[model samples]
Target: MRDPRMSAIGKGLRRRGRLMVQAVSPPRRVAPERRALNAVPAQRDPRQEAPGATPAPRAPRLVDSPVFVLSSVRSGSTLLRVLLNSHSRIRAPHEMHLRTVHVRFSRDFTADAMKELRLDRQELEHVLWDRILDLELRHSGKDVIVDKTPANTLIFRRLERCWPNARYLILLRHPGAVVTSLTDRRDNPDHAAICDEVLEYAEKLEEARQHLDHAHVITYEDLTADPERVTRGLCEYLGVPWESGMLDYGSHDHGRFRPKLGDWSSTIKSGRIQAARGADASLELPPRLLELAKAWGYPVD
Candidate 1:
C-alpha cells in the first residue's frame, strides 16, 4: 500500500488546487431574471434600528420597542394622539385609560374576566402599550405605535421597570385648568378637595422625573397656540419626521373609543377648547391647591 504520509500530502494538494481554480475562474454571470431576484438594494429606515428586512438575532422585548404618551387626564393628550396618529408609521389609541382603571380594577373584575381579558397584573401595567403596538401592526399596518394615555405620566415609573426602552411624551396643562376640568361635575363639587387629586398627580410626576430617563414634557397652551412647532419638537425628540396634517387630528376617524352618551361625548366631538388659560379664575380652588401648584413649579396666577 502507498505510505500513509504520501496519502495525506496528496489530499492537501488537491484541496489547494481546487481553491486556486476557484480564485482564477471568472464568475458566471447571472441571468437577468436571476439577477433581479438576487439583488438586495440598500434601503434604510431611520426610525428602525435595523431594517425589518434584516432578521434580528433574537426577538425584541415588548417594552423596549413601544412609544408612550404620558400625562394627567385632559391635558391635551387627545391632541397629541391626533398629531402622532397622522404619521404613516404610527397608530394610537384615543384614551386607553389603562393605568388608572387597569390595575385598580383588576381585583374588582371577576377572575373569569381577568383571565379571559388577558390582563393580569403584568399585562395591565402595559395594556395600552401592548394594544397599540399589536393593533397598529394588524389594523394601521404600521410598526410605530403611540400610547397616548394621560395617567401614564403618573405611573410611568412602574412601567419603566417593565419596559426600559419605553419613550414618553408628557402633556402639561395648566394645573388650575386641569383641576377645573376634572372637578366640574355636579356631584363632584368639592373644588378644594380636588386639590388632593392634582397634588397626587404632581407627586407622581416628580417621582417619574427622578426615576425615568426617556421623557419630554409639552405644555397644553404651547400646543394649542403653536401646534406645528410643538408637534415638530415632539417628533424631533422621538426621532421622527414631522408631517403637517398632524395638526388636523380632530378629523381622523380611527374609531378607537366611543365617548359615553352625554355631554362628554358632545364635548369631545366638538373639539373645542374646554379649558382656557383663565378658566380657573371663575372657580374656587382651595388655597392648598394654589400652594401645591406653586410648589410644583406651576404659576399660581
Candidate 2:
C-alpha cells in the first residue's frame, strides 16, 4: 500500500502550486475608463437644481378688461347674462362659478394646502378664470367677456385681487323676492335655511358696496322695469357703446343649459328677456330679511 504521509504531502503541494499560479498571474483589473464610467455620481442639492431643468408651469393668459356681474342667487343674474351677451361688444356666458373653482383648487384658501399643491391663490384664480372666460370670448366672437356668476359677490375681494382693473356689475334684489324665488326652486322650503342665505347675501352685498369704484349696483326691480335704460347705464359703466340689439336677447342663440349652475336661471334658457311681474308679491318676509330689504332700497312695509 502507498504511504499515507506521502499522499497527504502530495495534496498540500498541489494546493500551494495553485495559490502560487494565481499570485504570479496579473490580478483582474477594471479598465481606467470603465472605472471612471462606473463610479457613482456626486449627490446634488435639490435647492441647487441643474441649470436649464424644467421650469415651473406658467399661469394662463388673462382676459383684457374682463367684466364680472355679481349678485346673490335668484337676483336676475341669468337675465343680466342674456342682456350682456346680447351686446355686440360683450360676451356673457352662463354662470361660471369661478369662486367655487378657486375654492376647489385651494381648499378654502389654506396657505399650507396651496403650498403643498404648488399653487398660489392669484395664480390659481388666473388659470381657472382665464381659461373659462377666454374660451367664452372665443366662442362668442366678442371683444370683451362678462362673467355673471351671482355667487361671485361672496368672493369680490378675491376677484379684485385676481383682476385689479376688472369692472363689476352688482345686481340687487329685494330679500323677500330672492328668498321666495329660492324657496320656490327647492323641493322643500326651509325657512331657517332661506333666512341664513338672505343674511349671507346681505353681508356679501355690503362687502361689495365698500368698493364703489369698481362696483355698480342695479336693482332687479329696476332692471325688469326698464331693461333698455338699465342696460344702457351698465354699458356706460363698462365703457362700451350701447347697442339696440341688447334689448332683443331672444333673437340671438344663447347656448345650452348648464345644470352645474343652480336652477334659478331656467327661464333664461328660453333666450327671452321679459320682465318678471309680481313674482314676489306672495312671499311674507321674515323680520330680519325685511329689515335687510329696507336697507337695500326694497319696499318692505
Candidate 3:
C-alpha cells in the first residue's frame, strides 16, 4: 500500500499540471459577425450594430461625368485650367498624370495575375480613374471637374473606354511655339528630339478627335486673343452658364504651383491672362514639325 501523504501530494501535482495546460491553450474562434460587433467604434462614430450580427452594407460611391482638357505640354493647357477653375461650378486642377498611373498598372496585366486579383484590364483601369476623379471632386466641393493633363491626349482611347460619357476639350497650339516653350525651359539644345515629341503629341490629338464623339477643339491662339468669346463657347459646350469672373482668373486662388508636375505652368502665377505673343520668328522648326503644324491649321510661314 502507498503512504497516504505521498498519494495526496501526487494528486495535487496532477491537478496543477492540468490547469497549466488549459491556460496556455488557444481559445475557440469567434464568428466573423461576432468579431465585427466587438470591434471598437471609430471616433465620433454614429453607426452601431448588435453583437454577433452583420453590419449594414455601405452605399455605392458616386462618380461624376468628368470633363478633360487634353493637349501637349506648353500649349496653354494650364491657362485654360485656370480659366475653367475660376468658373462657379467647375473645378479644374493641375496635372494629375492618370495615364502614368495606368501605365504602371499595365505592368501586371498578365491573365493569371488578373485572375488572382479578381479584376480584368478594363475593370482595373476604371477603378483607378474613378478613384482619382472622385477624390478630386470631393476635395474641391464642385459639381463638375476638369482635369488638364497634356499627355492625356495620348490615352483618349483608354479614357473613353473607362468613362464613355466623359467630355473632352482639346487645346491646340502651334507646334513651333510649343517646342520653343519646351526648349526655353530646359538646357537641352537638341531641337530634333523636342520636335519629335511635339509631332507625336499632335498625331495623338488628331487621332482622338477622329475617334471621340464628344471632343471640342480649342485653339490656344484664339483663347488668348479673345478670352471672353472662347470661354463662352467652352461653357456652352460644357452645358454650364458662363461666369463673367472667369475672365479674371488672377483673382481666384488656384492653389500653389507644383514644380514636379511641369514648370511651364508658372506663367499662370502672373494672375492675369496675357495675350499670346507670336512664336519667335527666328526659331526654325524641323521639317516634320512644320508639316504637322500646317496639317493642324497653324500657318508655317
- CA lDDT of each prediction against the hidden true structure: 0.61, 0.71, 0.74
Question: Between 2 and 3, whose TM-score is larger?
Answer: 3
Best model per lDDT: 3
Across 1-301, the per-residue lDDT of candidate 3 in tens digits comes to 9999999999999999999888764755643312422333222111122355332232223564688887887788888988999998898987787765531232433534654656544455567678888988889888888888776777787677667678999898988888788777666456776677777888888787677766888899999999999999999999999999999988998877776453345467887888775677788877877776787788878
- Give residue 249's lDDT in candidate 1 (0 to 100): 60
Q: lDDT score, residue 159, model 1?
A: 63
Instruction: Candidate 2: count the clashes.
Output: 0
Over the stretch 1-301, how does candidate 1's per-residue lDDT look in tens digits? Answer: 8999999999999999999888765756753322322343232232222345332222235435677776666566776676677776677756554444333342344434644654344454355545545765677776677777555665676666556677777666667887777666435355654566666666676566556566787777878788788878988987778887776666666564444211244545665434334346777666765765575566776
Q: How close is candidate 3 to the true structure, as a TM-score?
A: 0.73
lDDT of model number 3: 0.74
Assess candidate 2 and give its TM-score to the true structure. Answer: 0.69
List ranges where model 1 is wrong by over 4 Å: 1-63, 100-132, 185-188, 260-267, 271-277, 282-292, 295-297
Could you tell me the lDDT of residue 249 within candidate 2? Answer: 82
lDDT of 2 at 120: 48
lDDT of 2 at 218: 92
Each candidate's number of clashing pairs is 1, 0, 0
